[model samples]
Target: MKSSESTNTGLVVGKFWPPHRGHQLLLETAAAQVAELVVLVYANPAGPGPAADRLPAATRAQWIRELYRGDELAQGPRIGTTPLRVFALSAEGDGVPPDAAPDDVHREFVRQWLARQGIAVATVFSSEAYGPGFAQHLGAAHVSVDAARRHVPVSGTLVRKNPLATAAYLHPLVAAQLGVVPPAAIPRVVLLGAESSGKSTLCAALAEACHTAWVPEYGRTLHEQKNGNLAYEDLLYIARRHAELEDEAAHKARKVLFCDTNAATTALYSYYYFHRCDPALQAMAAVCGQRYAHTFVCAPTVPFEQDGWRGPEALRSFQHGMILMQLDFYRIPYVLVEGSVAERVAQVRRALGMVDDA
Candidate 1:
């Protein structure tokens, strides 16, 4: 291994299992010393990682580009205007055998591949101990960056064990892929009832009282957009949009997420207005039941307003009864929210154990 001053062109190769900040620093260090830098990503096909956990080679290459692209969100130091190139070595083209050991076998394959590309490697940058032999074999100087792992202390293994704990060492996109919810998991509280049952008002009040985020009724948003000219096909879309918004809000929720409605409401409306509900809406409704930890069924006791959007007041009781039946069919636990806005909030907070009954 030699110092960085003797290098004109640098090469780096690693599995980049998740491309944590340590990998970012190694690439940044190489770019600082060399006129040009090339990064190669290699993940053994026979590795122990689950197929779903293994990110595609192309995706890792894109991560390299994004990390060094000089954006504020990009991790590690800015590369300024350094010429950087990323490559994913194909198992067939690069002659990387599935059973070959990572020691000399992988090093020789890398040397041959670099030589084939007419890349005269002046320096090989790495944080691993194999850097010296790999660089010497390629007739290039080895520039070891952070051998003690001080600068950006992290590893791919450390990340996989507890992703949410070490999330600060990962790129946003990479962290998201690992299913790391940045915020703590929160209980999703859904409000359910017939239209004009004060479900929306209750949802907002609960969100404010709990000091957390809330998902508004997407069905209402779509209704206002279409001037209440909704169709049977719109039920599924509204159900899907409601779930998407709920998921987005979950990441930002404090301890709980207040939702105006769930897919059960969508399925109920579909059967009520169209005389029959679609099978897909039924499945989504079932899935929604499993998502919310708690639900509050608003009682239809208030005066029914003759809104331009709602149906006849005569159907109010029937709608309310249908919601109860659907809730029971789905086996979703819910408390009946009755009385004024303050009373309803108090009931929900008590049901969710957000406050003591005293």
Candidate 2:
């Protein structure tokens, strides 16, 4: 028989290492039977064990809120009226001893902790078999939801073991935190160099060779759209767009995302045209170097072709030196890609440890 559910307030407690669909189901089921539902998310800031794998506690609590708050819960008509209260319990140096098993000692500490918060739980919900004993300790009836994991067919253990494999079972927000790269794991390669240094050509060739997605230079788009009249303010916008495009391409990449130009190159241009880089552009440049798994610095072996929009062709080598210095300053590792397009592509492939199937 199902346990008593006629209660004013109910609670569902869990570590929520990475909140999954199973947790969502348990919460929705509990909220359906109670007027108010208090979700006590147990977060271990110190990272309890290998099971946790250093997933942030605050992020997990936020995931619970994201899953249960307002319209998110409205889909379930029963959960709509139930006022959900989300709270965090730091499992590190908290109520119960760390070594204590999930028994009366742990349940009693949680019961007392809830009591101290002026919340008198009349029903307790959980997926574990020990829910009844835990509820009894708090003088509340236990409402077991998916005790056999038949409903959701997913668990924290499965998720922790391989988040990317079980990405479908996790909320978008939680999955993002666990490094579950949507689509697949793809190495991002940014081709950073001076103007007319074959960066665009090399990026396209690499993308084609690797059979991956590529992000074209956003600055070129902006320059074309604005008729080449670029202001200092536009530099930051270019940097921001570069990052956005990289993120977008990463989702579609097969094994690598090739970027024609990155934020560092944008910052260099800012200084080249405006005599200085904006603080915002500098910040973008600072972070841009790390965004790519690998960067290829194009050597100015090919003659600089002034495309009407470019600066003095004479400054190509100087600009190449500046790009190299910037990479050094950021401590970003990069390979100098010179010679022909085929040679540059081969160099990048060797660095990435890709066997030439061709």
Candidate 3:
């Protein structure tokens, strides 16, 4: 809450449980009017279930800071306190309200917090029901920016209920929060296979051989989170996000990246699990075919070990067949990788025409 004496200062307030496109638009609009903008991410304990139910206030502030750190619009706005200071505001008295509305109480708390920090707010910016009135209470100009009609509206409730439905409307900040990055320049190579196929092992080897980056399978992480039994949609979402991370890593990498798996594998897995296909899965598979430069199919060479999350041998065998069918259907050329880790690494080098000396 350290104050800066900038001539034009604006304060934006929100729960920002998860900062989204709507938040970005409001901030963008406020920046146009102010030389400096102070974004206050508010946390209220009196209104909601548990404070933990919402995204942490610190995390929300981080999203705002990251979104504006190098962004064009953020260059002039002075969005936060520490140069790029996105502030975190919390209600006082355990956030319990005696009589006032929770929003009003939170606003009053914010004003007190700013005063304590020796900061003066000139304007309050927001896109919420309580924004204008709160601004007036603080002796600041009020600006309400509408998010419903401008761009795609993004809401935390919508995202929590249906991430895929709102994924398209998510801002870059939200994508980053969810570990998604935009496509990069490096070549993306995906490794496809069933569980216990050593795809992850081979990916690490290939990355080492080429001195490049690799994206580990997020499915395993998701599987662990779900206590072993994952739904078809969960697998599909992880696969799609894995591909996205690969693209992002590729951009940051020197030459190329090794992806542990791709969307085609996910689509086939979904089909195998549900005996049907979803349009999102299909679209993801199609997109993967165009994005990957090469795909390495790890032939099922070993028996299914009792990995904490892996299925039985029968399921692995079935998944293996489905993978092959997907490759044929997509018409994507894939080199079959078999044998030890060393052998797989050599095959990858040969495929990419990169010799040890090179």
Q: Per-prediction RMSD in angstroms?
A: 10.6, 10.7, 12.3
lDDT (tens digit, per residue) of candidate 1 on 37-67:
8888876672336732346666667656655
* Tens-digit per-residue lDDT, 158-188, candidate 3: 7656555676556533543443333446777
Taken over the whole model, the C-alpha lDDT of each candidate is 0.75, 0.74, 0.68
Give each model a TM-score: 0.50, 0.50, 0.52
Point out where model 1 deviates above 4 Å: 1-184, 356-358
Q: lDDT tens digits, residues 112-132, model 2? A: 898788999989999998899
Q: Which candidate number has the best lDDT?
A: 1
Rank order by TM-score, top first? 3, 2, 1
lDDT, candidate 3, at 163: 55
Q: Which number leads on TM-score?
A: 3
Superior candidate under lDDT, 2 versus 3: 2
Task: Compute the lDDT for candidate 3.
Answer: 0.68
